[model samples]
Target chain A: MSGRGPSNYMHIGHLVIFEFVKWLQDELDAEVYIPLSDDEKYVFGKVKSLKQAYVYAIDNALDLIALGFKKGKTFFFVSTRLSEIYELSVTLSRYLTFNTVRATFGLEGEGVNSGVVFYAAVQAAHILLPTAKKGLLVLVPIAMDQDPYMRLTRDIALKAGFRKPAAIYSKYISGLTREPMSASKPETSVFLIDNEEEVRKKIWSAFTGGRPTIEEQRKLGGNPDICVVYEWLKVFVFKDLKNMNEHAYKCRSGELLCGECKRMLADALIKRLAKHKARKRQALRVIDHFFLHEVEIPSEIIKILE
Target chain B: MSGRGPSNYMHIGHLVIFEFVKWLQDELDAEVYIPLSDDEKYVFGKVKSLKQAYVYAIDNALDLIALGFKKGKTFFFVSTRLSEIYELSVTLSRYLTFNTVRATFGLEGEGVNSGVVFYAAVQAAHILLPTAKKGLLVLVPIAMDQDPYMRLTRDIALKAGFRKPAAIYSKYISGLTREPMSASKPETSVFLIDNEEEVRKKIWSAFTGGRPTIEEQRKLGGNPDICVVYEWLKVFVFKDLKNMNEHAYKCRSGELLCGECKRMLADALIKRLAKHKARKRQALRVIDHFFLHEVEIPSEIIKILE
Candidate 1:
């Protein structure tokens, strides 16, 4: 997977979804090639220096490694460092016309940069690189809004003599006001850096459709099905089915209040993301060594080219 | 300057123009950087493999070296192997909009390719490489038809924070039909590999505006200025002002017949290009090493980023 490193310092959304990457490695027995696309970071992320992007990639990769991924079992690489990857991208970009790329991305005027255009081809190449021999079932987990890029990747892959990747779409978790939660909108989502108190405060202020008065809520009952907090609890917390169903039924029958429900959800989320913070800290400590020695292109490959 | 190598053997046009490059080193006391743009060559030149292009670039560079260019004074590089050059090109491409490039190159839909678009940026970057800080006075002794590219480079330099390059345009030495000489069109130009007998035969058949009969020619003189053979002598041979003017006046006054003029020009060209044949043979000897080492980016630069 190639993209800018998560900007919100890795939240519940990152933890909940990326846990599947670990599951794929251990249970499904797949050799995961995680291309930490510092290329994307330089183009889209706030960073300007390619070196800074390289270091950030190392930090991000170490976080992934700490999630029980064996070092050799998973391959990590930066996009700019790989010549074959860039060449492949240039070739693919040649095949795709400007009109096609413009239409796909809704680009007009001067909005589209060469980096963005080449980036699409790079993304397409990434999906095909792993399955160069074909017939490999490649699964991409992405937000629903990013479906357009996946569709474009599938199209380019079909034309570039490669296998198409299947995608698993996931919805974005919204804030209390039902507004889409984004890293750009700091107040909307709880970041990994947030303390227990901050997480609790954010959850308490979250918008819910529950009644203001206890008497009114008892008569009408709360609709937990459409509640953002309830959805978060189901998606991020309550791994056991029995516990999840009990909470759902209690909320629908007005047996539980909104305040109590938020408290329970926030506590579970805080516990779930607590380990990543320690792991991130540890990853930062050994980052220099990883950046210098571990992330280097294989010497054998360099010798062969030489 | 990275490009796929030439598919066909080098022609007189290639040899004659490159000779001026040697002159730049011999007379001007300048540092030379030759980039074998294999990436551009792959897209434009009809070569089978990128490796083949690399081999061709090495061969060509060695030929230039054999022409008496000092090793350390003149550097050789390939486009695909130099990521820093490509990175700079990519950055410069951003500053240049698609419309500006398209308009500058007079590119229509048929001529527009990703390679062509990126190549302009690469060429622009080549003229501005930081190593060229000694004031880039690029003496491009190309055909007048290629003046647009030099004009574009000059314009780009005005906007870009880099030194502008100067160009020296040479008129095309065309074939019997007044068509621009090209290796692709075998009848249009002589190849370095062409035999002496074949060279004589081509010169005999070459076009000239002379009277059909010698008696008529004495009455109505030939237009030596329009004759391809005479132009070749003036451009390639007869460099002295007195000799060139004497030849031109004699032909115009019908003192020298068209057949005699063709014979003299052919003999001079054959003698002049003889040195290149030996250099070409030597160039092939070290071609492998040239391809292997010429274009690779320095490890020190990569280390700096790390």
Candidate 2:
């Protein structure tokens, strides 16, 4: 349970991942550690300063908490607050050679900053947080694009005599434009923080699989395969197989209009966003309940100060 | 007043630099900071673990304190012990881009680990430590090899709206074999921690400008220009120009034999080492006297963690 600090508001894509993590935690009956890398946000130039990243981290953490993860079991830590993470990061970095990280991150022969190169270790520290107390069966729930980071962490953990964490990768949720959902381009994403009005506006302008005219749509059935709304329904909005099947059938038969489908999505999202906003407000009050202190400092690290 | 943690013992080369720093502090009536980058030593593969490097840092600090620096004015900090330094290090790291640092350090397309890459930022933090309180004239007494780091620090500091530090470069004291003294290769350097026996042995085998045969050296004068002993005398032992001139004349005229000169150096070093040992013992008793707490955290950084 780790993510780089958000410089912008998180989109629905992040919400999907957080929901998945909560499910995994419940299934495995395991503790969750969420390390917010605010330092990385500044170091990587994603934010103007650490203060901005810190605000993002707090805002993002509130969103995660709003998803209703177990309070005592789930712990969130900011990278800047815990110096031990950086120390451990330095330790974990030793297991990875420059050549290996360069190749792994596709930075070979490229001008990657030292902070970016070193970020792998900090990320690895978050993944191996469970190993500090004692080795445990670990599972990293992440998106497919994060597979490389998981692989690197597994390699370093194994080398350091810790259990290698298993990864379960989820498919990416596409933007309304049929591209990857990104927070940087706010217009492309339906953010969890957006109000009902904003959600409806975005959905109204969203790309769809409808024909130019009603007669044309009736003659040539809509192609749900190319529809962002249909993809979103399959991945997140519509979880019931029977309901999803009916929606797909209606689209193929030209019985379901694109406007109606978009309106349905907007309504569902508006209700969901309202619920999320209330929970987020509650989460802000009890955010400290899930905060974690410094991890157990290793004896080797203790010896350093002595 | 900052140097990377010593993986091995402090050589005479380091002693020269420390003496110069002490001189500057006395002349300027200023505070001194000595940051031992134990984290970097491990990151750069100079030591096996942070523990090893930490021990080395302590030993090196003892050596510096033994040089009789003002107890209250001189501050020593290890990278692992100080969280504030890590925070400042992360802040400074952002000002440098990958292209600039890589080009400056000649790490472009090279296999340099993240620890090594990030180390430059930590080094820069030490350089800019004075800026935390108020802008003041800063003089970094460093060897010529470290000029690149100073330049990088200056560039970053100026951009960050801090006073640029001034650097005064020192000529390196060569190894007994007439090469640059390095802690990695113990045999090449006469360490401050070396015992009388080891000192005698190294000096006995030291490279000199003496001829192969004593009879040949009497006919053809010995070249003090290439003599390690003459260099040592000029730099450390015989500070007086008149005494150095006489020693050089004696060497050039073949009046002083290499063996006698070696014995003289050995005796001088043995006495100096003994004095250093006593002060080191005293330094260990009051190590806490020179320990520095976190420098005043800037409002910008405070806001980050707030």
**Which number leads on lDDT?**
2
Tell me the fnat of candidate 1: 0.15
Poorest lDDT segment (10 consecutive residues) of candidate 1 chain B:
B297-306
Candidate 1 docking DockQ: 0.25
lDDT of 2 by residue, B47-147 (tens): 88876776677777878988888988888887866766766778887776666777788974656667777778878888887675446567888878888
Error of 2 at B218 (Å): 11
Off by over 4 Å in 2: A39-45, A88-109, A155-163, A204-275, A285-306, B68-75, B80-109, B112-114, B132-137, B156-162, B176-179, B184-189, B200-268, B285-306
Q: What is the C-alpha lDDT profile of model 1 across B1-306, one tens digit per residue?
A: 112134555567665665676686678887666666666666554665566665655545655655665555665666666555655665555556566666776776633545556566667666566434455556555556656666766776766556667777655566655788776777777766677787888788887878899998888788877788887777778869899899888887889898898888778768755776666566545444443243432343233223
Q: Second chain TM-score per prediction?
A: 0.80, 0.91
What DockQ, between 0 and 1, does each candidate earn?
0.25, 0.40
TM-score of chain A of 2: 0.91
How far out, in Å, is residue B203 in model 1?
Answer: 3.6
| Candidates in order: C-alpha RMSD to true structure | 7.3, 8.4
